[model samples]
Each structure stands twice: as structure tokens, then as C-alpha cells.
Target: MSTKHFLRGMATVNYFADNVVAARDWYSELFGVEAYFQMPSRDNPAYIEFRVGDDADEFGIIDRKYAPEGMQKAPGGAILLWHVDDIETAFARLKALGATEYDPITKRGETGFVTASVVDPFGNVLGIMYNPHYVELHGA
Candidate 1:
């Protein structure tokens, strides 16, 4: 028998919200495109999904009421950072749009990387970063 690894990059990101409808609407407005996939019905969906970026990364929103067993409803955890051209602008935009700052933007200086994070109103930790390595490896 042969053992192999098949761990690829992130394909889906799920966000839990108290109100699925509001979360979906908020994300729709932010993304500027309606969700291409939804469960039940778009008008009253219990779960919603959106495909984003050139890679078609899966982003999802699910009602907290339906949260899986043992899932904590706290406001802290591992952050999933999205690549951005300008960290400052992205950080500012998120804050202006009501996302409270969880971690202020900080430059790594020598590494040519900067990162910032915000707690979205729906309790998800939204992160934004300017990573030169990512640009060099994947292009901006």
C-alpha cells in the first residue's frame, strides 16, 4: 500500500451568524454579488454559500441556532486572512463598515508583510494582510 497526502489549500470557509439572512445580505453587499448557492431558498435560507476570487474559494454563512454540537460561540479564534493590495485601506474599510478592530495593522518590516484583523458584527474574525510572498508566488 502507498501512503500519500492530499491536503490542498483552503477550499471553504464557514462563518456562523445569529441571523443567516442578515449575514447573507451583508456579505452580498460587501462582495457586490449575490450568493450563487443557497440552501432551502434565497428568501429564507438556513445556510448560504458564495464562491469568491479567481480560485473560487467557498465562503459560507450558517445560522448560529443550527451550530454544530460543541461549537463555541465566543469571539476569538484562528483568523483566516484574505490577501489585499493595501492593508491600510482594507483595514479602514472594514472598520468603517462596522467591523470592530481586533488587531491593528502591523508591519513585519523585514519580511515586507503586514496584517490586521477585525471582528465582524456576526462574530467572525475577519483578517486582511499584505503578503509579498503571496504576491511573488501568486501575483497580485
Candidate 2:
């Protein structure tokens, strides 16, 4: 039997924050673009989103109050590494933007895969990577 590929691709990744507006502004500075969507109302949004990267992947910020009960309010979860053209520059910018280091930059083998992660001020882990394989398929 052929194994079906159930997980197709990444659609959206959301980070929670106590202050959604602040989170939105911070991310906007990093992304250099304003959020194109906000829910409920801009003055009192429960969620906001941006279309990121060449593929326009969904990156969202949600109010912490909307998180499910028992969800951990710390930077511990799956770290989704977004590809960056310059890992060092991107990592440095993240630090300069008030994010703390969660994982330092790490070079993986000789295939040109590098990774780093940081905890955003809102306590969500944000991962950045320099992935050659991804570039080979997607371009810089």
C-alpha cells in the first residue's frame, strides 16, 4: 500500500501574547510590513495575521486569553524554523529587537544547514535557519 502523505505543508503558525497589539507592532517592525488582517476589531483584536515569505505563509498573533486551558505560557513547543538568506544578520536583528536567545546558532554537518532560536518578548520561541536544501528548491 502506498503511504499517504497526511501532512501536506505549513499553513499557519501562531504565537500568543498577553498584549496582542504590542505583539503585532513588534512583529511588524521585524517583518517591515503591517498586518493585513485583524479580527473582532483593531482596537480590540483577538487575532492578527500577516502573509509572510515568498509563499505567503500565514504568521499569526493571538491573544493569550484565547489560548486553550492548560496550554503552557512559556517558550516550549515545536520550533518552526523559517529560512533566512543571511542567518547571522537575521539572528542579530532578532536579538536587537528585544528577543532573548533560546538556542544559539548551530551549524549542522557539512550540508549547509544552520539554525538558531530565540524567545520573543512575548515568550514564544522563534526559530530561524539557513537551509541550503530549501534554497535549492525555493531560491533566495
TM-score of every model?
Answer: 0.91, 0.95
Give the clashing residue pairs of candidate 1, or none: none
Q: Tens digit of lDDT per residue, candidate 1, span 1-140?
A: 65655866897899999888888888887777889888999888888999876578899998888888988887777889888888888888888878899999998788889999998889899888888988988887
Superposed on all Cα atoms, the candidates' RMSDs to the truth, in angstroms, are 2.1, 1.5
Q: What tens-digit string does per-residue lDDT give for candidate 2 at 1-76?
A: 8676789789999999999999999999999999999998888889999999989999999999989899997789
Hey, what RMSD does candidate 1 come out at? 2.1
Stretches of candidate 2 above 4 Å error? 1-4
Q: How much lDDT does each candidate structure score?
A: 0.86, 0.94
Worst 10 residues of 1 by lDDT: 1-10
Q: Stretches of candidate 1 above 4 Å error?
A: 1-5
